[model samples]
Target chain A: MLLKKRKSKEDTALFRLEENEGEIVLWSENREVSRQLSMIDLQEEDLLVLQKLRPLVKENIEKIVAQFYKNLEKESSLTKIINDNSSIDRLSQTLTIHIEEMFTGVIDQAFFDKRSKIAQVHLHIGLQPKWYMCAFQDLLLSLISLFDETIENREDYNKAIKATTKILNIEQQLVLDAYQKQHDEIR
Target chain B: MLLKKRKSKEDTALFRLEENEGEIVLWSENREVSRQLSMIDLQEEDLLVLQKLRPLVKENIEKIVAQFYKNLEKESSLTKIINDNSSIDRLSQTLTIHIEEMFTGVIDQAFFDKRSKIAQVHLHIGLQPKWYMCAFQDLLLSLISLFDETIENREDYNKAIKATTKILNIEQQLVLDAYQKQHDEIR
Candidate 1:
């Protein structure tokens, strides 16, 4: 499937930033933003591959999210982090949106902006990178299993998983960047 | 101090790719490379901060690397991995070179190509991401201590450490990308 060029930032209404003051203060807006879409090599082909998974993800998002939180809940420390900073209901809804967004395949400046904001929220909640990375690994495993069961064609399944991995890494990079910025600001 | 724009890919020769067949096969060459220097928002100023630390890193690299490996030696699993894959002396020398490269303050395609090769080597050695990250945290702590003791001004120390962290994260992202590629290739 041929994927069109990414739409202009103004063309997309999906990744709108909230006007909340806490979020504004938390967001690292002044940092010199660069072209991230290129950095991770997220190509139009990768986006096309991801767009194809939209239906698969939409159908299984609830199950996928449930599996993710179940794994997170296995550790008491992670559970405490959630209880202290956010409720399960709130996090579940947010994550469902996040999963759907991954398959939207419409990356733009706003896409990175949203990831940046999420990264800040994670920082505010005192989520350590190790735990975050661990959780993401679990999520990736779940997605791989989902694709394996759902997608019969071997090549297509590989393409789908590969595409998913790239988008997830992009998300993780933004989080890592935010974590570094927080460290820079702490003193 | 004003910094010059990044030098083109051809000018300097710090990060030369090796001609070893194993190295060539391991390096993910056909993968579409992106402008990562921008992706991580690594600027000339960060390079300038790192460049200023060249002498400091140069003088104490031995001590810093010794501390890093000493910390690793405490972990039996890490020691076993080193024993199985490589000797401490060999790894130590490679790490010393790696740490010095971090402070060289030069980044271009060759710089990234070199990092990509290192990531492949790590995979070939069966070094898990968890262990790799744990080791990196130790190295960063050593550098932080080095900066804390040697750099007089608090602000300069912070800038140096932040710059170091960005370059390190860039390296990590490349590894993560390579790891994902390996997973994609595994079947």
Candidate 2:
């Protein structure tokens, strides 16, 4: 037997697992999304793993963010660009929220929708793809290091990371398309 | 002539660059430290690059944060972790400050000091390293993708990342040491 529930967004994604099964399965538009995307089936041990890693990620994010700003300030070229509008307080707040949300995971349709909107926002601003990729790599490496202990099974951990990277790559491409379309419209 | 300056906590360790006089000049206390710690000198173009990317990063971070909290709400095992803590707001505030500072090139000694303290607090609570690392990686990836437009050269970008990563590794080790020493004392 299968259980189905619709998430609020336009995607109408469903969370599924076998009836009486310990894990949950996720489906979108009558097709199965990856199990990793489905949170319903997370076993007790899986939940424990996520719980254990959340705060460490939060803390390290704070550190990486601090460092990123410091680099921006010191670089004379980057300074003038931000001189008019940016502030340490504002940037820090933005990063904090972002990092916090990563651990918490996404559940709401509104939340996912907001992310789609943010992708549009990036297009308005003219972000380059390479820069986005570089930043992602740095952030990923730091995060992996932070969770080095809890990920006792290096192979599984690596697989999880590869999966994440793949998803992120897709997300990046989508944003890039949105950005290009916006740019063409403006031109 | 080499310009000597007092090391600021915010300053990346100095390294060797060919001087105008064609001599190798040391930028910091030690060659290795300098090599490992130097930040990219910002140029006007780089500033423009960063300016374009900043907002996207900001937007992405916020979206990620929302999703994170939503996921936490859905999970049974994680809810209690936040039961007694009103600290999420405080943490968010600190994170905002931290990210902004990264772009501004200003080093906040107080901020770093606070994070170090927070690490201790987590350690006291028995938070594992893996949790922090996972969250950190997630945030890092999100922000990186947000800033994809500003990165010019992948090689230089990767080098800078390596430098930053090394510094973070050092910082994490220090925090771990402090926590361990304190833990030992409590015992």
Which tens-of-lDDT digit does each residue in B1-187 have in candidate 1?
A: 1111243424432222122111111122433232333333356667766776676788889998888777666556668988999999999899889888787767666777786787678777766554565556556656766765555443454466556766666677666666646644653
> What's the CA error at residue B114 for candidate 2, in Å?
47
TM-score of each: 0.45, 0.37
Model 1: residue B160 alpha-carbon error in angstroms: 40
lDDT of 2 by residue, B147-186 (tens): 2233333332333333333333333433544554555466
What is the fnat of model 2 with respect to the true interface contacts? 0.03
Error of model 2, residue B134, in angstroms = 22
lDDT of 2 by residue, A46-156 (tens): 333333345555656777687666654533434554444456777678767865554443333443455557567554444333333334444555564443433433333
lDDT of each: 0.62, 0.42
Q: Best-fitting candidate, measured by lDDT? A: 1
